[model samples]
Target: MSPPAVPEPFRWTASPCGLVLECRPLEGIAPHLFTTRDAPLSAADLWRRVGRALDAERVATLDQVHGRDVVTIGPGAPPPAGRPKADALVSIDPSVAVAVLAADCVPLLLADRRSGAVAAVHAGWRGTAAGVAISAVEALERRLGVKPRDVTAAIGPSIGACCYEVGHDVRHAFEAARHAAHLLDRWFVSREPGTGIRESKRLHLDLVAANRDQLVFAGVPEAQIHACGLCTAMHLDVLTSYRAEREKAGRIAGAIRCRAYNPA
Candidate 1:
């Protein structure tokens, strides 16, 4: 079957810093965004921008080790003394926003519609192979008592398969991780001619597809998942792309905060 139609739940809006992609499905339910290259110069600056856009006071982020580990921020959870080394963050506090920074890797934002919990994940090729997306979903279920079916996810722009050619080691890594063979076949595509070394024939891995499938496998309804379908490499004017810009690329951020609950 064809993949779900391109998600229409996101809207790009101009901000003081630049443009930010907001997930419409989570509007009013949460404050979230997929930041663009024009975000800010530093993390502090970015948080300030996010605060202005979302009216949030405090934001939490990770060191992003490109692993499957997920950290949870409960209500009133204290800020970490330093950034934690993890790839994903989830929170139940409306006062605290969770964010993940990325250039080429997928930046995924999720919200629990029922409990008002939220998550931000950075899923690169390695993290995707390690099931980072599924880990975040399970973290919400186990830590926040969120039901996967009630969660909505927004996949931000990343290095699309059109430009993300990888070596065979990437495919081997997924295979060694014991991911379903058939699904692996679908996620990794053979590189186009003249793309990579002619003799070796590199592969292009779909980080978005892998993470989306993982969310589905973790119980999120496919229809509820929205993908921006914008490739950072192809749209560098609007997004950052590590692969295209190499070390010069600035990182984009994806952030989400739980909706404040006013007890009647």
Candidate 2:
């Protein structure tokens, strides 16, 4: 069966810094948005602006090691000595916003409706193969008794299969990571040559598909997960693509803050 069509496209909204992309499902639950390339501010200033827009005291960021490490922040949680070396950050504190930065990689924002918990996840190829998204869902469950089914997720722009071509090394790495065979087939497809182009043998891996499937596997309802389906390489005017831009590429951020505490 073909993959589900992206339910909705992310829209550009005037934000505190400049224009940013907001996901409707996540926006209804809490303060959240995905940064775009329209803004000319430095990376540090952009992050600060995002935090201010969300009404958060400060934004908690991760070191993003491209692995499955997940860190949780909440009451009594000690301050991180420096940036924590994790790919995902889960927050149950309403005053703190968690953010993840990406260029061609996927930046995912998740929110738990019933508990007001939130998470920001960064999943590059290695991180997706390692199941960082799933780790974040589990972190929410383990830390605040939030169920994955109650979580709503928004997958931000990234390198789509249309522009992302990889060699056998990436395929072999996923297999080595022990992903199921069927999923490997669905996420990785052989590229077809186009008009005036030679038949390229490289495989195209769908990072969004891989991460979305992992979220479902972790128990998030399929309908609650929204993907913008924008290809960073295809829309450089509004997005950033590390693969397409190389050393000059700027980062895109997905930021979300936890909901205010209300004693049950």
Candidate 3:
């Protein structure tokens, strides 16, 4: 159950069960990790183990409808009967951890340094178009009294622009969603029809850039955001990719817990 070693900015931690990836900046903010494909367990088992390893009383996840909904978790709040249909989970309860599962989509983790609130976001292209990242940041500020400038984000592995070619329909969706024109231009890289032996015009969406920009737009400093920049499609040795493995793909999770559980 050992994961292959990853590169700088991301270190792999080994244990009896498997490996999890941690980044330095976010490591200083909270107890968090991005799980790998090397774990020899079902997704549920692995997530449970993640909660235990972080010493979290419980871990909260979502049904991930790929929308902008944000769910807030607290120790005193009653647990819901079913997983909430949302793309993001936020918590100020230090005993509770928040996590998001993904294969090709981005698993983004956010932590508030001043307030010790954390959020786990699942941002696919659809979620990105829907501004899910901005929603989470705003939720932290509105519900937990955390400022966007005080939040630090870790953008996990997912499909990268290098391999995420899209058709005009995808571009049209972003436009219809009302993302700023400049951002659309930057995120969607284009290749002319006759260039590079290709027969048609192509566009590639940079999911990382899109989400990072959205965070900055929400008032999180550009310097405070950290992107693993590892593409799930390219790093199949340790990561999972639905686009690469198709029906056989397993999911990876980004989980985070507040450093301590003080409710004062």
Candidate 4:
């Protein structure tokens, strides 16, 4: 079956930011999008969404290494480095559209209406364990002078707990992280039961839940966060999953740029 058409065509903006993009014409915040190696489509297919007149050279990508590092790109900001070991990108200039490519990792988008500052982040188990979302929130508050309460955060599709199975290392990482300590038992549950016979166990990591906690911990209000609980692994008809697609899978992109400045 063909993938469902995107809703909203490209308009998925709230007050202040003045802009949004969708995957398809009707898909909210769907354009300004690209396919991953896990999706049904590939980067070559993404070109169609970008338009025939656009140049592929304009698209930027990083070697994302699951770290809390963030880069600023605007005006004279240097071009993106080869898969920089980072998770977040921030900019106040509307010309630049901050993007994050992910198969199951949380596609986090942050925008401040007052300053027109926007951020795109890739937060996965490692990223969440490393506090990448918190880093993005901090960057917005410090660099953009945005009140944490006013920042609108959108936590896009990712691998939900039902599909994410983790190892001890994953659980340990969260335990080692500062604020993550509270969700220890809750984050990691034993798949096996019975006394003295612990055969197997798994970390049912709720990456989105963890990120939401991080946002709130950083002072973002609950109402400001918009989480689209669409699981990539569960929705093959709409999303792409690296775990399911492996190397041959196509990717899905989450992107945003300032639009109030657009005269068109």
Q: Largest TM-score belongs to which candidate?
A: 2
Point out the worst 10-residue segment of candidate 1 by lDDT.
1-10
| Residue lDDT tens for model 3, 1-264 | 455454566788864237778878888879898888866337457756887878887778789898999988865664454699999998877777888889989999998887777899999999999999999999988877788988899988899998898987887899999999989888888666455312447888899999999999999999888888888898888888888999888888888988853332
Could you tell me the TM-score of candidate 1? 0.91
Off by over 4 Å in 1: 1-7, 41-44, 192-200, 261-264
- The segments of candidate 2 whose C-alpha lies over 4 angstroms from its true place after superposition are 1-9, 40-43, 78-81, 193-200, 262-264
Best by lDDT: 2
Quote each prediction's TM-score. Answer: 0.91, 0.92, 0.91, 0.76
Residue 185 of model 1 has an lDDT of 77
lDDT of 1 by residue, 15-93 (tens): 6456888878877578888888678546557788786777678778899898999988865566575799999998877
- In order, candidate lDDTs are 0.84, 0.85, 0.83, 0.63
Taking the tens digit of each residue's C-alpha lDDT, what string does model 2 give over 124-213? 999999999999999888878888988999999899999999987898899999999899988888767562112446889999999999
Candidate 2 vs candidate 3: the lDDT winner is 2
What's the candidate order when arranged by decreasing lDDT? 2, 1, 3, 4
Q: Write the per-residue lDDT of candidate 4 for residues 1-264, one digit (tens) a residue.
A: 433333332223321111222323212222243333232334354433433212223434456788899887654675565656678887654444556778888888776655666677888888888889889888877755667776677777788888888887777677678654556655555545552212455546788888888898889888767676667788766567888777755566666654332111
